[model samples]
Target chain A: MSLNDPVDDETLLEVRDLQKHFKVDEGLISSLLRAMTGSESDYVHAVDGVTFDLKRGETLGLAGESGCGKTTTGMSLVKLHEATDGSIRFRGTDLTDANEEEMVQFRQNAQMIFQDPFESLNPRMTVYDTIAEPLRIHDIRNETARVRRALEFAELQPPDQYFDQYPHELSGGQRQRVAIARALVLDPDFIVADEPVSMLDVSLRAGVLSLMERMTEEFDLSVVYISHDLSLLRHMCDRLAIMYMGKIVEKGPTEDVIEHPQHPYTRSLINAVPVPDPGVGRERVELAGEVGDAIDVPSGCRFHGRCSEYIGDICETEDPPLEAKADFDGSQKVACHLYEPAEGVDSTRVDDVTDTTAPDDSAASAND
Target chain B: MATQDEPSIFADLDDSTVDESEEQVNRWKRNLRLWRETLGEQWRMLTNDLLVKLAMVTMAFFMAVAIFAPFIAPHQPLNRQYETDAELIIADWVDPMFIDSESVYVLGTTAEGFDIFSQLIYGSRAALLVGLLAAVFTAGIGTLVGLTAGYYGGKIDDTLMRIVDFLYGMPLLPTVIILVALLGPSLWNIIFAIIVLQWRSTARVIRSQALSLRERPFVKAAQVAGASDWHIISRHLAPNVLPMSFLYGAFAIAWAILAEAGVSFIGLGDPNRVSWGTMLQSSRAYAALDFGVWWWFVPPGICIGLVVISGFLIGRGYEEITNPELR
Candidate 1:
């Protein structure tokens, strides 16, 4: 797990310090009519210096609140959103510099599953055609065969019955299964599934999640599963990264991070997950203020404004670098001053373990 | 031991069951069935709508007449020398006295010996051609510009939107008049004027839709699927925007037809070709009111009203078909 352990030879994808900044501008004439209309401009640093690597057949969960840039980071990996800086190496080929043709080849190996079941499938396309579309684009001449294979992989039995079905005719879960089938038709090795089950009903969500889980194993697929649902991430991911304000606040083995989160933001997120046990009541760590805009991220630690345990000076003036906490098995990393070893603070106190309790069985899991 | 070692016939069935391709085929077939079901639903909704059915009938009738104007009309309107002269063309076809002229015109005759009924029938050909062609021109140009601006955004969006603003500022009627004067009063010239003057509105509407559609999860899905910009625009974006384009195209055609008539009424259309507007102009010039010749003005006015009203009805029908929220 250490950085020097000859970086996993099985690593299928690697993202290093990726960033995407969108520039907001004023209307056309106002900006053009006068050289200086003083049209104030701002940059939304959607994915700011996010770094991660995906091992072959491993599911790395990107858990974060909305607007934390997990989706943007996922997009940058496939060259969907052009990265402002940094390198995305897919099978050792740098995606940041890959021309359109190179990216097309890269796409054969990497694909994506979107968040919404309602809107993700093209309404104009039938199920058969929707799944066949990728095969056509990729020049898979045996489109019927490939589509059939993909639909099978998605577990939609008696595929003939649903071949001509449109999105609206299918239930929410069925639509998502079709979306997954479309993605799987290409036989891609890697996938960025951005909250693929977020739009489904509670009952249907588990079915899609389980299907994805089974497919991941059956296909030997490497995936970056992005979602704000911590429990679901626990169920599906091998390693999980907690993102806050477009930065990875903490990341490690799923069990390790959830059981022992080093960053205060990660701790708060873990604390917020409701437990389903009647005997024990869980303590909630409510976030202090609203999330600051991406354009004006706080100076030092982006979470300083919202961190309840913030120590004034260092938290504001100096940014904390992502470093390994001692208790972690060398794989875990956290970016917070609280985890940083201090002169007066004892090493044991540095962990700052919080009271962990299970929630009442009667309490429903809060929707993220 | 022999029985246990023997291979079972059901092994082949099990193999087929586990065959990945077969499973996929089944899934695909199921999805297709579902899609057809949805389309069936949409069709049922469309058929049940009274307004939609009416519009469809009106459009079908107009288009049929426009297409077969030569065969359907008793006298060829464009062929002025066809048996009927102006006096015979508009006379009542059922009357023995009118039919006795042997130059039978189903509708009637104009004041200047031109066939009023024939002219009206032929005039439809010109009106429909201009309206349809102008709509194509406007929709094509507007959709291209709007898609690029909304998709790429930033500087391109700003610049394109400014151009739209400038066009919006200009008075459409005066601008069309000036352009027509410079370009000369021809049918094609009039169509060109209508397209140029009207494209701005289409672009504005398309841009607004594009702005919203561009952000949809499906658009993002296409992007992450590694679809090129052209692929995304044509496949993902175009299908979503097409219904809107068709809806707006209908409205644009209506506008173009009105503009064509307006120009012709002002005596700016092809001088040789007969149109409803020419009939109006000539009727006014001849002082129809003073002579008590109601036939000249009334027939042409009624033709114009029928076309415009039908166009509006058809456009409404299309809106209902594409927009489920409206239904």
Candidate 2:
């Protein structure tokens, strides 16, 4: 039942303890105000701790609301923001310690697809230059053929038509396609798509997402598709990892996670998704509480304040570890006290295992 | 509702409008539209700003003077009344600003017995040339250095910015004069001094611009694509910094002209030519001020002022268009 077990299916990237925190030096006046208010830190914990595995020829969806660190996790995986502290291994080579030469090699193999299609492509550059750039950089000098190939792959057919056009002239969907083409030109094995279709129109979103899905099989690519849309993730991802405030609270096979979300946060997110029939209202966990500030993160469970399944002092004092749910036998993982038998909730119990340590047991599903 | 699903209101439009097969015409129209969208916006702003419009007119007028110097000049600028003082045809003592239909000396004559009007016209050419050439060179060098510094942060940024800081602390005009004085009077040397002092401001401004732009997602995407430092700087940073380059170029031209005028005014100019600055210098040298010959100095000074002001206006107009907050 544990599909997430560490299978020997050609692992491409293993991102562990990925953290990217930005210091906010908000002037003398703000410092004075902070001093008076007794604030602890002046840091934005953008990606406090994220851990995930990317298998070759697999699409992993990172789902979370805005400011939940999904994008940050994706960015740091490619060393875009420079992981504050973590290890990212590519095919067993530790990328976190990679020198410039090695980093360049890593970049050649792993490309990034940014969120904003319109803003990510240089407005001044023609579509040819945008796609041709990666080819030129990686020393793939046969530019015309490669750029044309990439363009075709991105489904911008009649490559000649789009070759000379700038980003402004292209439609939003076309622009995103060009971005995909730019990422594809290098023939990279791994691609981190950070909310790739988030800024795209609802009508065009499905097309781009499916194109990404098509790319996985075509190129044999290991892709991390980061988005907040559960439905979109359902369609695109083989495995899903739901993040909340810079931590992955639940992760498993996409279908299983969507069907039976174990984490309180994941359940709320799934419930929030609009159903076609208005009368079939969701028995949603109506979370109504102040979202905790990133700088002043709450002790114990970060989600305890807004969690509907507030397990009294246990939820408040002991931050729940992401654990493989007892009944599912490691297929579905949830980070909440309710899943722990020691915390007195046999809500979704199996009675198969003893109480396990938090950190050692699960930072991420081992996928063994 | 879908935009294409809606029935076309212009069903009865002209044949040309409906002809989708006229590909060449359509291509030309597209080109026109793109050009109009980019430059037309700036052009519209230029015309809209009263000060900028006035500046453009003034610049056009002076540019015309520079271009038509050979034809408009009443007499050759180097022309003296005599090869030697003994054979002087026009007297130095002739009334200032005296115009005569019979003589080429429309603005009378200077103390050197050279036509003042001719000198002013010819001087326009030097002013425009130095101003333009210096500004162009400055913008080019500054932008290149800036792109390198900003795109490649840390040591390169520190070193280049420190150099700019060093240059900034130096009194630009005074140092230029001293350098020119040492190098001797020549147009190229004057240009060299101005350029050395000129590009610092452009570099500093562009460096900051490049810094902000280097952080943009597009640039990061380029980095993720395995683009080298040179590739990022040239392809990404340079193009984005172009609008600012233009803004600075105009301003630099104005400052260069002023700097040249100041240099020549202090007798550190190309002694062979009669720029507006040199004309003023000559007036002082000949003690024309002592003789109450006000016409000799006034024309050149006004020309320098007008040229510099025009450059400022044009630059400001450009800045307004490029900077959204300013607009």
Candidate 3:
């Protein structure tokens, strides 16, 4: 992977070790009390360290369980939540260091589609005002023309018909479409769609998803689709990154990751999805334990407590780095101790390393 | 829900409503139209409540009486008739058509020989002036403070809320009494006192509301759209919190009127101005109730009650509209 290169001609968004931590304290009084007592203030490590590259006109899916920091990563990419550490470069401009003018320029070229269409739109503003707001903010001319075009693209036909209507007057599908129109009104280069169709009815999901696909292709937009639904990600994304507790455990082509998940966490996540066909019976790989709180995250790997393939003290004591294995092509990377770092090794398979260390799979499972 | 096939009701109408040549004019017209729509919706909600309707009617009567006080009153409020040596008597038998000096008193003459009917009519002006000014200032200051504090929380919220909490400790009547004493008795001073003390409630209420609304996804969406903090507060947050502030404005108006009355009844009213409270104060000095001079004190007292009840009715109706959970 071109991880060493900060800027590439084709890479639209390069996020390196992004982290966003939220204070766990209630209010200022608690902060003052904590200060007076000389105790460490606790924090929710929401997005600890995530790294990804989004190529121009590419759709990257961030698949994770709830609270796994997929949404935070998406938000940080758009500079909605300022990353606590690391860097986010959008078209070679460092978003973290962007000043007022640069920030404004960045905002004009980037947009976000929130999960809840009902809440994402200003209830007081009409459809036209909501879509026209970005144009007004940027002082762009011909706002009526741009807003009408966006509405028409969103499939709200005869845009003038819906201009006066409020979000309350629209159905779930229509409301989501309005939100899409608002995001697209800016003619953004990059878009962060945080579960855009999750709130809509299942029947309405396909239409909105197809609209988004059309938008990505039509605008040549680099997009990040954040969702816990693997099926949705598999359908929309070209490249998929599976996240577990604020870290991407595996990343590869969507088909490769879905068909052959290397990391135990990724395998368990894929297995959790129910198969619609009753004829094709597959063994369900249920993992132990619940998702840990972000406050007191487990030491080594975050998924160690939940992984069924718990490998002894090595898994418990050492943090695993995301590295490509010799068995697979260099494009796929997995973050598990089962796969030794293949950077210096030559043609070393995963089982060859596990045989010398653990002797047997059952023995490693017994260590749990 | 509107679909592609089903066009809106006004689809065929031309853009004649907002065809202004200038951008500022168009924006202003759009805002005015939005306000009209919001107000029309609110009016529909208020009209459903009979008490609110009655309250509006009562307020209209007082406002009309205040606006046309000079035309409505038979004599100047300050015109005291010492030529005839009038005694305090109920003017029930006095003929209003005959403008004789002795029968000129409509409701009755005070011991000071001031026409009670004239005083009562003109008193509405002072009551309304104090109420409207105090309410507007209080609501304006409170809403601004609340939106600021709630939008930029942390230290700002702490400091603003602490100040509000400190002010909330002030007892309304005593604070106004002391304030008027220091400022010297005047209509403006009473209004100033009421505004200073009354705005805290509105600030606290609106702050709580803005705090919750600040977390809504729409607010985040606005931020992502590169809206400045000021624009977000004024354009987005202000409209959302305004209806609640108006509800508080109604309460503030009622409070201001009553506070002015309380301050005036204790002999701190502007001596040059004739308010309902000043009339009550004067009647008390002559023991109008004790002497069976009901018209001297009863009219001003009833006017105060009517205005306060109307305020409560309007507030109740507005509360139901703003928070449908209450309905």
Q: Write the per-residue lDDT of candidate 3 for residues B120-217, one digit (tens) a residue.
A: 99999999999889989999999999999999998999999999999999999999999999999999999999999988988998899899988888
Candidate 1 deviation (Cα RMSD): 8.8
Ranking by DockQ: 3, 1, 2
Q: Give each candidate's interface RMSD in Å.
A: 10.9, 14.3, 8.8
Can you list the residue pairs that collide in candidate 2? A4-A367, A5-A367, A5-A368, A6-A367, A6-A368
Q: Which stretches of candidate 1 lie over 4 Å from their true place?
A: A1-8, A26-41, A281-284, A327-331, A340-368, B1-108
- Write model 1 residue lDDT over A216-290, tens digit each, in one string: 876678889999999989999988999887778787788878887767788888888877877877767889888
Write down the C-alpha DockQ for each prediction. Answer: 0.24, 0.23, 0.35
Model 2 TM-score is: 0.78
Candidate 1 lDDT over B1-327, as tens digits, reads: 002232321112233335557656865676677657867976676658676667667667777877888887766554443234444553331222254465455445555556667677778777888888988988888888888888878789989999989988888667777888999888888888888878887788788878888888777766666666788788777777877787778788778888888888887887777777777887787787686666667877886777777677767767887876775
RMSD of 3: 6.3
True lDDT of residue A232, candidate 1: 89
**How should the candidates be ordered by lDDT, best one leading?**
3, 2, 1
TM-score leaderboard ranking? 3, 1, 2
Residue-by-residue lDDT tens digits, candidate 2, A1-368: 24535577877888776788988767768888888999754788888767777777888899988998888888888777788887789888898777787887788888899889878999778898788777667665445666777787788989988977989999999999999988877767889998888898999988897788887876778889898888888888889999888888888889889998878788888998888887895686877786689887787778988987675776666666665555444466677767632334342333111133453223333221
Native contacts kept, each candidate: 0.34, 0.43, 0.49
Quick one: best lDDT, which candidate?
A: 3
For model 3, residues A255-315, the per-residue Cα lDDT tens digits are 8899988888998899999889989888789988899879987877678888878777767
